[model samples]
Target: MSLSLIFELSIWITSVCGVLVALWLTWRAGKQRDLSALAGFAVMMALWCFGHLALFHGYQSLGMVLLLANPLMPTFFLHFALLFVNEGRACRPWLTAMTRHIPWIYITSIGVTLYSIWVNAGATIRLMDDRPFFVFTESGALNLGYTVLIGVLAHAVLLLGWRHHSGNKRRSILAMFGVGAWGLLLATSFVFPSFGIDVFPYPMLLLPSYLLLLVYGVVRYQILAVNRFANRALLALVMMLLVLCVIAVLGVFSGRVGLEALTNVPIWQLWLYSLVVLLMAALVYPTVRRITERLVFPGAVLNEQVLDTWSRQLNLADSWTQLVSDGEALLRRQLGQTVTIKLPNDTAPSGLHLCIEQGDIGWSAHVEKTDDLSPGMRLNLEVFGSLFASSCAALERSLALAEAERKRLDEQHLVELGSLSASMAHELRNPLNIISMAAYNAPEETRKHIKDQLARADRLVGDMLVYSGKLSLQYQRVPIKSLVSSVLTTLSTEQVSIDIQVEDTLQIDADSHRLQQVFINLIDNGLAYVRNLERGAMCVEAYLDSGRFVCRIHNNGPQLDDVLTQDELFRPFVSKRRGGNGLGLAIVKRIVDAHGGTIVHRSDCGWPVTFEVTLPPDNTEGDV
Candidate 1:
């Protein structure tokens, strides 16, 4: 009930909190050597605080027992500092040398404790200005020397480690340094009462601050990889205790303002104060957590703005593939971990995975890091996965409807073209045949010109039928070089210089006549564009690559119009060349499609225009 009693009880509570912190850190240690050393340090710290408490209560024998054990406190701290710097890396020379001295320090501590016992030396509780303080005898100086030696050595090691480390490790070292310095300063102040300095030793009552700093290191800098749930619970517990400790200290100090006021205050009033503190803590906890998240563990919790942006990007994706790729990239950037998104059919990459399914869509997302994801991150990922699945499902349905409409339109177009082709063949080819027969009876000089006109008209009719009609392939093993050379021999080569790069033994299984048409159309385009030059350049190449037959026709002529879309470039009626129906490439495209091949336009191969035709391996064969 007295002010002194209240202060003593506050110290007792703080000592107990230190023990609890020791247990918590020990539980978190796992198999990590650095963490084990840290747990050991915490244990010694708890014992040191307990030793002071025992001395204050006049338990001389028990206090001496604890005091004898206190010499190992600095040893544990030094070992912790050394192990921390060496974690996940080879030991540095300075740390290695420092580590070599640990056993000697341990030996010296034991010797000092024994000497202290032999001399009957330890601190005695004495009243200093009506407050209990520890006063040490001269023989206790050996203990002080031992403690100071180890404390200085540990701090020096921490300083070096801080300078040598970077990022989270550096920050962790700095936190430990601050805590160590405070502890050392407090330990030094304990010797002041022996010198009659009359210091109140208020630093001893602030022992809980050491535990708070360590918790901050674990939560903020990730000194220990505790999960988000545990972090929150531990933080809440520590904050509540801190608030109560602050309140209790205030209650004791208030007795100075009105000595008789709190002295006669009923015990129930104190209980009422504690209950109100608890209620206030509940109300303040959310705000405290927000501050802690923003300042202490920044970026660990994804904010609404980030989640909203991620969702928006995911919804904007046009296909399931795009959605998965973008989602993984976003998560990788946000979490600083390698992320993978696996569809139901995709093999999952190695790591911890979260499977999410929405509607008929399902995928698993994972990070390469083996550490379990924090609760906030895991929840964010799940939400992201759900949003991605829903968006992908909607996109899939939309695409399916669009594809169906596209196919229907294609079928209608094909029917119209078939009718048009039949009409053109019936209406135009008969007149071309009659013109050819009439040209034979004309005068020799005039008959030559008429024959040329008749031939040109006949070729135009044939191109239209090929463009609109389906191809029927007569498969044969066609030598690629022989086919290309035969097409080139049919065309006049005066205006263009041509290069052929096909191997004589290279062959493919295709319709020989239809395939020849493919080459003639492609080679004629190359010659038409290069006609302005006295000898423009062109090259024809054929080869097998990756189980597919490839032929590339390259020319130094002007490139295809950059403004044309892929579909427009292959349209039957589209032509940019003079005196030509645009049916040459269109017919080529039809024949290539019937043979299960792909054609691509290239501008990246140092050519003005190039068309690459790639046939499916099934429609292709090795050399004959």
Candidate 2:
């Protein structure tokens, strides 16, 4: 009602509200570790309000209370600026050091001012009739030094805000206001009248506009209130309180203001007032909450669900196999689609496909690093990534498991090929040895039959050696034109009209013996097919296309049937030639691939079945 009461009430209420807010904020942050700056801001705010209260309560000379507040007040301003700027986390270590020396700094500074007042007669103070107490100090160099020191510290905070200049304009402006406030307060309380003006007063109101600015950043733009649930509850309370006032007023206006029963009752009157208030509040709060939630919490609940689901999924998935199955199911459930995990193959000698899929989602073959894993999760042991992913995640345990299975199957395949080669080599040798012995013992007429058997044995043994992987390579760059000529010469004796259309001087960097063996296999087949006719056509053509040396060997042979489908023709121990071991063409393919190349068998149907061999041209052979 009165000016003094109003002033007293404003100071007490502001002080109490500020402290309570600070306490709640600080306590909320204490439960977590990362929000140190937030907690620091809270504690600083509390100290700041306490300092303000001291000055406001006419307690300045109560053991130097006003001066005691000086150190913390500036510090709270700096810290508040930091937090408001979203740069608080980076500020504290320096301020912690500042706080450590604050006691000494404040005591020394206060001592000088007090000394000047008591002993030097340079400083004084008085209570104003129209104003509160004021510091009456000089416009001396000491006063300038005080303003400069506070300005330097406050400006230091502003300087730090430069990194966030574009990020936090509000903080920057507020810090400037603080610097101005300190400077103005220094001038008015210490320098203004001494220089000739009655007032140039800048006090608590100078910089605090920025607190409202902060509230705006938080409420409208950043909305940091949701970060602390207390703010939300407080908001709910305010809305409810407003609704209560509205309904109480409406009831008082609509009905009798002084009803006997309502006015006479003591407990009931209070209860009626409270009930009316609560009833009105009930009408408005849910609507306010729904509006706020829509604005502030769109997709928030869904985000939480995702986080919870991921945490649970990771917990439930244990082994690589289980991990894969769970991942597949989870992804299917969450994403409503199937997800395939694949890794490149390294040993397969394919480009960018090394480190092949270890397995599906969860497989035991992956010796996963569990140190960084939880009960339901694993870390990719292959910390190194050699291939690109749709996203850059190490193969999950499920995918790793699938890849492991593939590797095991490849190993088993290699083992089976080994055993088949050994059996074929054994079957070919027995009769060949006996025929050679019999031919040595037989007379001339009988010896011819055994010699034929020995020749058959030689072909068998050659195929056996290749299938067994015992064939040695005489590797060197050889001219293909000359090599093909020799193969044609050997097979030309058969009743075949051979046309050689060759790419001359085409050098291949390969095993001459192995290449010769491959050419012989094709030539021999061509001879067999063409020889069946009284006279049949055969041709061998070699040329280069796209860095590959392509050799086409054709004969007037029957078209290859469906039995030799593209996939089946490459299988070892399956031969198309009569009494021929299936190893020859398979061996030819293996040799070509060993030299960093690929070969595919295709039948060119003319009068003849043409076999095509495509070998990757060597870089060295380019010039040769």
Candidate 3:
């Protein structure tokens, strides 16, 4: 090939590559307003490259028509920059006004150039050193105007870059470099020729390189915010290119071996050859796709296995600490690196990190030797991180349910033991009372000690029976005020002040004896914990609330300890006060439950301690 033909071919190839890359970028960028502006910019660049290719091929009219799109390129770029900064919202009024007139400016410049061409006073094209170059035959006003317009747009884009750099320095620098390089090339193409320099449009050949830099910015910084569909489209494009390369290679070999026969071949044979090539591509596509996926995403298989194992382990994990430790160990094994897991209050190490959030709980993981991670490995890590978050949430819920079940079973076992002990105590009560009666004629001190021991044994048996549900209630309409008076009269010797707030007519359907026992246990328990017996006070308030008879028994006792607050207060053998069997509240709870009532302890009812009970009311009406 001649030097000029070789140069023309090189320019054509470069233009074709630039057009392909730009079109791909346009398709990948999708339909967001900012991305649409970017797509427009890419289209203009493709048209500009096509125009130069056409000019090299001696298609002057076609080249001029395509080159008409060139002036719009910088305008599209500026629009893209404005949208990028403002996130596709309306920009400053000045910027909006300036952008609105860019098309008019382009039209006016094109009009001047066309008018000059019509009058045969336009720029002339001449062959110098076997290369065609443009030279203005008259005043170079058109070239100067185009150069000035591009310079102004370039400065505007640079300013935008500077403004955006503060928040995203890497992406801003990359965008600026790409835009500046292209602007420099575009300026040199016209400015050098306008200044009487006879160089060809050598800068135009660098269009493909400029496109590569922009594409790098898009891929590295997600400039256009391309989605997964774009990634699949890019993969398809790569596959198509690979197929084309194969066909090209086959064509070259066939031409070398069958040059004479190929020249003599009929049109039908060419069609047949094309059909065979298409058939081969269709058959090879799936196999090629699988291989490419394996090569490009080598961690996919391992990621699937790791995720499956992670899910199973989380399901089986008995505790949060166990789950986190196992997850960290699994990740370390899969990635072949040290991993640090951080809980909510733990300090996070400096490294590449992923955050896992489960409700209000958050865990962060720092990856050691991050430089060893490939793109595929990083992708796997993201999938694993998301799974870890959801799994941790599931594990927490699972563990909570398990603990609740364990506590329920423990309570059931305690109830069974209480029943056995209560039965034994019942059997011993009669014999103990008989012994005390028999010793009635003995020495006074001995008889008195036996009587005290017998009374204590009887009280213990009563408490155990109530706690174990061994005692049944005989429900009757019991007046609230009278019942309270009776219980207080029995314990009147205790130096504690009692306040009653129930009406005389308020009554409830409960076993009067059991109801008295409930009050006696609660009042006596309160007195036991009171800090000052002389000043210690108790209040018994009753009212009808929400279709139930509500009673609140409050005392000025010490607040319950933290340990006692956590499910220990109403459990047998767990006491907060001295000289107590720990069964008073437990028996009280059982009796209330037997009467189909609810009782709960409250420390926030303007009292140091309070027990509120809600019971079914009797049919007889009573005043509040």
Candidate 4:
């Protein structure tokens, strides 16, 4: 083939490849609005490639038609840039109307060009070495209008790049360079010729190079969200094409440099060369694939590193505060922005927020503006948020388990202390009884003092035995009202009034002696707190609730502290009263628990203080 034909054929092949790449991009554009605009730009470029092919084949009319349509290509590119910069915001009404009219304007311009061609007897058309081209004899109104249109589109693209550069520096820089370089090449190719300048083969050859740059922009800057399989496949195809091109170049070099001796080898040697090439390709494919994957999709590697680092930080964190602090730092580093985490009970900071909740723990991350964040970064943030929530949940569960274990150990210690107190009280009781008998025969005042000391010691011993669970119950049918009345009579101090509100027939199967002790302790506690009040009185009310016998002892004393819950009230050595051993409530709780009952203090029961006890019925058919 002649050199001209060879050059033309190379242009034809490059244009065909460009068209194929354009179609592939269009097919993979999917639901992204900005990507669809990019796809439209690709299609327009493909049309320009087809036009170049037509010019090479000497189809002047078809070439003119395609070339006339090619001016719209940059308009599509500008539209894509605007949409991408705005993150696919819907265009304003006037802008939408302008977009809708762009095709009609292009069509009118093409019609005007064709009319001028026919009217002037195809004076605008010319042939250089049998290849068709367009030349303007003068700067007519149509020509000036088209130039202004291209200028406006180019300026808009530059403005978009300038505005978005700070937020997405790499993509913006690539985009600006691609647009400027392509525009320069296009002006040199077509407009310079209108001024009678010869820039022939460079224009045709450089068009393919410009399209390759565009492909690079798509791959490197990620103008679209291409899936892994499609991205890898495109890379593999490009690698294969490059390998074939290299082989062809080597063959051409050999032929030109008088290396005919190598070509004159036998047919089997050619087969061996072909097999060697294939084997080399098979070996090089994976290496090229890895490099391409790293180059085109660095976000995948970044995501993995982020997750690994976050997991390590979470593991190393000893508390929730540290975990949150580390997570905030990790997010800031990975996302390339400041991040503030607002935990439960923390004051919320002002910024764009992403809230994360795990069980009872909730936190919000105040981050940079939403528009500044890329889709990949947003996805990574979501992943990190989930991981953070999970870690917080695990930490909370671990803390709760530790607290429960501590409570168990404390209860065991209290039990041992109670046992020791009971043993010591038992040994002291024999000496106390002998002193009481000896004091009865002495003077009246000494007898009264000895009796009072002996009674106080006896009460302390009874309390220790009850707390230690050493006292046994003798269950029998007992009337509730009579039991309360007898305990009040025995312990009356005349300082606080006692009110009984139990039905005379209401009966419970419980140890009478132990049951009386529970009432005495509860009443004494109420009297101690209510003695200073103007209407100092204790009310004992008994009723059945939900198939269980319930009793509520209420007093008009100071309310329980809001900070302490009912569960805390039953713990050993915890009391709100002064000069008290703190075992009265604990012993009462043990007696109720031994009888398979639940007791809870209610500060909100319309009284300052109340203790509600619910016991299973005498013949109830279940274990407590």
| TM per candidate | 0.46, 0.40, 0.43, 0.46
* Global Cα lDDT for candidate 4: 0.69
Error of 3 at 366 (Å): 18
- The Cα local distance difference test for each model comes to 0.74, 0.54, 0.67, 0.69
The regions of model 4 sitting more than 4 angstroms off are 1-308, 318-322, 336-372, 389-397, 400-404, 434-443, 470-477, 493-495, 509-513, 529-535, 557-568, 576-578, 594-597, 603-606, 616-624
1-624 per-residue lDDT for model 1 (tens digits): 664565577567757766776677777768766666767766776676677667677776776767666678778777877877754443587678767777887888878888887887766655643544556678877777787788787778777777767888887777776766676665565667877776666666566666656655634556434556557768777866776676576567767877657656654566468768777988998889898876654445667898788878887877777877787788788777766776666676777554434443343333334356665566667666666666666777888998999999997898788789879889998887788787787899899988877777778888877776666677888899999999888997786888899998998889899899999999898888897876699999999998799999999987788898777887777889887788888888888888889887888878889999999878642221
Residue 119, model 1: lDDT of 85
Candidate 1 has what TM-score? 0.46
- The residue ranges of model 1 lying beyond 4 angstroms of the native Cα positions read 1-3, 87-90, 128-133, 223-274, 277-624
Model 4, 1-624: lDDT tens per residue?
Answer: 464565566567656766776676667667766567666666777776676567667687776566655446766665665555443232345445655565675575556656545543222444456556665555344643564576476456546555545545446546656656685665566565666676564455556556655655545456444445457667766766666666566565776788887656554555457657866887998789778866664443354666788888887777877887787788777766666765666676677454544343453332335575556666667677777777777787788999999999977886797778877887999999889877878899988988987887788777776787555667888899999888887874476877789999999888787788889989988888888777798889999777689999999988888888777888767887875767899888888887888899887777888999889976322222
lDDT of 2 by residue, 1-624 (tens): 554345445445545554554554456555432233334433444454454346556555542343333334444444444444433444456655664564575566556455544543233333233434334344334534653576466556656555545544655455455545554553354345444455533333323333333333332323355446546656766866675675556555544655655444454455467767776877897788767765664322223565466546645654445644554465446434343333343233322111324335522222222343332222111211111121223335456788899999976776685677577667767867776786786798788877876777677666655655534455588899899888767765456788888767688777787788788877886676668788688877888898787888877767777767766776777777786667767776766655555666556446447777777666332210
> What clash pairs does model 4 have?
none
Give the lDDT of residue 56 in candidate 2.
52
Show where candidate 2 strays beyond 4 Å. Answer: 1-6, 13-64, 67-72, 75-107, 110-132, 137-148, 160-304, 307-485, 488-624
Candidate 3 deviant stretches above 4 angstroms: 1-316, 332-378, 385-415, 470-476, 509-511, 529-532, 546-548, 557-563, 593-598, 602-608, 615-624
The lowest-lDDT stretch of 10 consecutive residues in candidate 2 is 381-390
